[model samples]
Target: MSNLSSIYIHVPFCTKICSYCDFCKVLYDEKWLRKYLTSLEKEINLRYKSNKIKTIYIGGGTPSCFDNAFFEQLLKIVATFNKGKDIEYTIEFNPEDINENKIKLLKKYGVNRISIGIQTFNKTLLAILNRNSDYEDIKKKIKLLKDNNINNINIDLMYAISNQCLSDLKDDLEKIISLDIRHISTYSLILEKGTVLYNKKMPLISEETDAKMYNTIVNFLKTHGFCHYEISNFAKKGYESKHNLTYWNNNEYYGFGPGASGYINNVRYTNTRNLNKYFNGNYFFDKEILTKKDVMNYEIILGLRKIKGINVKDFYAKYKVNIFDEYNIEPLIKDKSLIFEKDNIYINPDKLYIMNEILIKLI
Candidate 1:
């Protein structure tokens, strides 16, 4: 068995659902939350084995929506794992849910990182997207986090809304840079099926316009000392998210609770997305045991999502196979869609928009 060292817990309840979000979440209710926590504790205990966990990420449906008692109980359960050595612990919070009390509770529980959902600064656009926060609220929460000495803060931003002009995006970037946050994750709006935005036929920016906006954000962040570590994530010199890096690097991780997925020891598993099923102790999620070929293809697909792309040396060290020899990458290299240099391989700058196509060819 592979040594498992990373854990991800998903809390599937939110105070309000965003129109554009397709994540598994439900309208929050106190009674439902209490029952959910009870079930969550049982799930954790059921999955707990003597594995050395190096990182723990409490992602959500807005984990910060939980009250102090629930948060404390959840942390107490997680504390059963290793701590105080070199572990990185993170919790995702919605901007409106953050407060002085919550920040204090997080610090008490040894949470070293906070990922805040601040989709946009424009109040009008936020309303259009049905996101629940104003600029003032976001600012206050960010200041509170900083005042509480929460150093590693990750801010989430979005672009390509129906009426979002380039200037609006610039203003959002300005507000974000003004905070001097350690990390930022920016994503283009995707109208997933079943989302309110998709149902309403919200307009997405044209391909050219979206590309320009993306490139602009990248250049601006780089000029401000934030490294574009991944396609959607920018971080200062050493503030890269270790928990997320485990996923990008294809390392083993265990996921618990509802709607959480994990890749451990080359086997990919997903916990049940249905909250009721999980609460019923079904653990009815799917699993895909990856073969050697599956792993090699997945490494290429996932690694290309990073701005620095894949390190051929590290790939060979882990899999004992040269990546180029394992796949037909020559056509892409000749077409200027892929680049190989300094023992690393990455997608060409201009062709990053078509990375999926290039990866499809490789696979």
Candidate 2:
């Protein structure tokens, strides 16, 4: 194995912090921006192993917010990697952060994919999440990217916002479908402990309503020519997120920058989210080497997230134990919570909402 086919770099600076975000982030500062990119270059030089990389994803605290000079420098550092002819290089952008100049820069540097943070189209819901993009802004930005011939795009959406209703959700979906993008990732809001929304005690709608809305979105997207291939993602044919698929398939990759995580050589580790610690060259919090059982458990938990599920033959080939014998799945299948077909074991569509409970029993 070459050990470095995929890479993810986290850029932790944002122009405006969203109320619901708990990810490692800080408000953008020019001095810190220069220092952070320097440190990022150092970290990449030290840890990145394989020169031939295929899939690269630059995620954020709003990566697209970097000023043009710093943004070019950041791209220059990654360009050192030996890239394939058609590497799936992606960068996360905010809807308002992109313009003609940035679009040109991205295309010039071979960034083939763009993921936008357009959480919702409703005004009140947008304000509640502290997001600032509007319909016109997003539509224009999408056109800008496509006009530059960077057609691979993904947009993020959120539901279960404070005071959100089923009708509001359906309307959002209709607008999103009309955009004709390649990928969409929709998540239900979770009130993380330290976020502004959680501190303010923003209302999380009823579980019944949440369930209904989730089901509605799934059906709506399916009806609109999107494949609900993963739990929280849909895509047109041949446009699935290859970088994320690396994680779901349990493949190894590099995670760089503050608050990053990486798995290599059967060991999983998370870098420190502490900025000062990372700047001081202290990145890892700890590392855990997986035992056989631990690896199998991870395989099941992550693989089951996809619609195709886990292949039994591959499982036995990897672990030398039939999953049927290692863990009791027959009962789940019998009860209609899971299905075994085409030599793969998958969660039933109706039971996907309760996937956690079923996974608990499997583990």
Candidate 3:
């Protein structure tokens, strides 16, 4: 079997565009959906090395927005993969797109994980981000998934919007915890260039407030029994996202569909975001072949993202080089900005907010 064991399929069609989103997406259209699927299947068949994939994440532009027939077809296309027996198949969804029929199909196709974009239960913040979801409606949807035995569920909770207070975030966390979901992915609102919020020049909450909110989330979730497994992810014990861990661990995986990216054979590549170009079969947009040094650098950068940090022995095993000899970690360790505990080297829990600066110094 090939070494690669994870797959991410991007379905770039959304029923509604959010003001803060700059992902590759367009309005849902049946015509485009049919064409996109055809190209996606061809790309997978052409590029996939036929490994027994252990995880498959169908993400982006709302994978749950499709009508019944199209959704089943998408699942059928994915079923062709040589999946492992205990696969963690996941599909991202907007809360409103979920229904009994879709849940049944997901159960039939063996999709065990569901990541819902419940980016705050506050009505005001929902309007600000142009997202449509009612708290009651969201609860009902969660119940539906659980009733169908699709219990490995995750909900996204976003914060740091303009004019949002720490109280607002606390309230959102309370509601989220009450849902009894297994995982929570938290994000601070970022106004990327070309996004509606960025174009409108929406003011961001101060860095000071943002940091406070992040700490609040960390503390609150910990009290509620969620393990802060990664920088932006928390889960009940044994419920962490295996697919995302694939990226943070800097392992190879397959990415199909427009705007998706994959790392294979020591090379990282992204497919074109342009639909027209994608339709014409120009699958590759950009690629970088990594040198040994390049790969090691990636190892440090991606591996450090996990809260547990990098295993020095694993680093040496993979690269045949000592991590400390290669980089200046002693200074950070001396300053308590990084912790070298046992065999693992991780960022200091207190200094995690400024991790970028520390990484810059080390890299």
Candidate 4:
């Protein structure tokens, strides 16, 4: 087995499920959370041999929703993993659940980064999305985080909601940026199957409007010194998300808990999604032992998400094969959808909106 430099712990309990979330999660219950955490510990010990983790990301239905004691215990178990002196530990928080006590616990556990799920400050949109926070609550939480020295914060924003206008999106962005936070992740609303929104037949913004909003976000963030490092992520210089970069860069990582997925030694595996099955000791949702072709294709798909794109020399070195010959991407290159320069291959900026179509041609 290869060494894992990154680890992801999924805590699948939320106080309430958002309308658009299809992630594996359940409503908060003390008994269920205890059982899940016990199983999660076992899963971690079973899969990982070393604790030398450079980065640890605690994500979930809402990690901060857990009780302070439970959160402390989880962090103590995580401490068993190989965490270096410079480990970048992050925990995702919902504004409704974040408090002074929770913030202190995060600091005590060596958490250096925090991602707040402040999708929007608009009360109407918050209600529609089933989010349990208001602008005032979020502002107070931000102050708490800052007071506790948790300055490495990232805020999530969503656009393209039904009836959402460009002006509304601009207001949200301005509010988030005005917080002086170093990073932001903005996503266009997608009505994924199996989510509450989809089941309720909720409407979404028109494709044309969504595209315009996305372009507006890119331009606006860039003007404010936030670099569009990934498709949906923007960050101030030197503040890019290191944990997520591990995934986009195609590095080996370990994932533990329900519905968590990981890639190691060219094999990708997902843990069981069923909480009962997981607690009963049945894990490993689905696994794929990828071939060389599978790896190459994945490299292309994931790498293209980054604006910096794939390094041609590094790709060739990793596979001991020429990328040009393997994918036959010259047609895309000729059409200006793909560009090859400086030993790197990337999609053209203008074609990023149509990345799927371009990737289909390459694959």
TM-score of each: 0.96, 0.98, 0.99, 0.97
Candidates ranked by TM-score: 3, 2, 4, 1
Q: What's the CA error at residue 80 for candidate 3, in Å?
A: 0.2
Q: Candidate 1: list runs displaced more than 4 Å.
A: 1-3
Task: Report the C-alpha displacement of residue 130, candidate 2, in angstroms.
Answer: 0.8
Candidates 1 and 4 compared by TM-score, better number: 4
Better of 2 and 4 by lDDT: 2
Which residue segments of model 4 deviate by more than 4 Å? 1-3
Candidate structures ordered by lDDT, highest first: 3, 2, 4, 1
The global Cα lDDT (0 to 1) of model 1 is: 0.85
What digit string (tens of lDDT, one per residue) describes model 2 on residues 65-111?
98888889989998898798879999999988889888878978889
On residues 1-363, what C-alpha lDDT tens digit does candidate 4 reach at each position? 444699988889998889999888999999998898799889888888785788899999789888889989888888788778888899998877778788778878799999988888777887778886576667788888888888889999989987789898998988887788989998777888998889989988888998899899999999999999998999999989989998888888888889999987888999898999999989888999999999889889989999989998999988998998898788888989999889889889887899999988889
Model 3 residue runs over 4 Å out of place are: none
C-alpha lDDT of all candidate models, in order: 0.85, 0.89, 0.93, 0.87
TM-score of 1: 0.96
lDDT of 3 by residue, 39-89 (tens): 998999899878999999999999999999999999999999998998999
Q: lDDT at 87 for candidate 4?
A: 86
